[model samples]
Target: MPPHVLAATRALNWLELVTETMRTALEALAAAAPEWLIAHVDEEWFERYARRADDYRLPDGDTARTAFAVTVGRDGIALLQAL
Candidate 1:
């Protein structure tokens, strides 16, 4: 296959993985903290996250990647605290 095709395939796979992971996380959250999920998470929030995940790209450099990871970590922590 051509390089562009290979790259597109990988990106699609990554998106699928992210989407599936988010779905699983949402399921677990709904099961474990239904009240919290209902209070904090809405359909719009899910749609926004899904859109962002679909558009997500890896950071270009190490510093950018680290910052991205840190931001994601902080978001996870905030969600946990909310729960």
Candidate 2:
């Protein structure tokens, strides 16, 4: 396959992985921290998160991907700390 085709395939695979991981994380979060999710996470927030996860794309480059991961990690930590 051409380079562009290969790249696109890889991106699609990454997106699928991210989507599944997000779904699993959401399920675990709901089960493990139902009270926290209920108090802090509104319905709108859940809808927005679901949409984003369903349509998520991998960041364009290594630096962007790293930044995205770091931001997510920080956000998760902040949420946990708020509990």
Candidate 3:
């Protein structure tokens, strides 16, 4: 049997809404500085991009990915390839 990779597309903001851990972090960011990405995240790699910031809230418009999360933290985006 092979490991399964469940490709789930989500808006970058959606990650902060739907995922509890993310919400906590992002909410703090929103409260403290509504214009910057928060700590607990590797902002160096993951870019915070939005077409309209608020308008790009729909997950349906995200690019399709044939990958899945590993230890999805606010720090990284890991896709399982072969393990």
Model 3 C-alpha lDDT versus the unseen true structure:
0.37
User: Where does the lowest 10-residue lDDT sum fall in candidate 3?
Assistant: 74-83
Task: Write one digit per residue (lDDT tens) for candidate 2, span 40-79.
Answer: 7545436534644432454676577657656555545655
Scored against the true structure, residue 25 in model 3 reaches a CA lDDT of: 47
C-alpha-based local distance difference test score of model 1: 0.59
Clashes of each: 0, 0, 0
Runs in model 3 lying further than 4 Å from the true structure: 1-18, 38-68, 74-83
* Local accuracy by lDDT, each model: 0.59, 0.60, 0.37
* Cα-lDDT of candidate 2: 0.60
Per-residue accuracy of model 1 over 1-83 as CA lDDT, tens digit each: 99998986675566445545555676788789887787876555454344334334545554764565555455456566776
Q: Report the C-alpha displacement of residue 73, candidate 3, in angstroms.
A: 3.4
Per lDDT, the best of the predicted structures is 2
Report the backbone clash tally of model 2.
Answer: 0
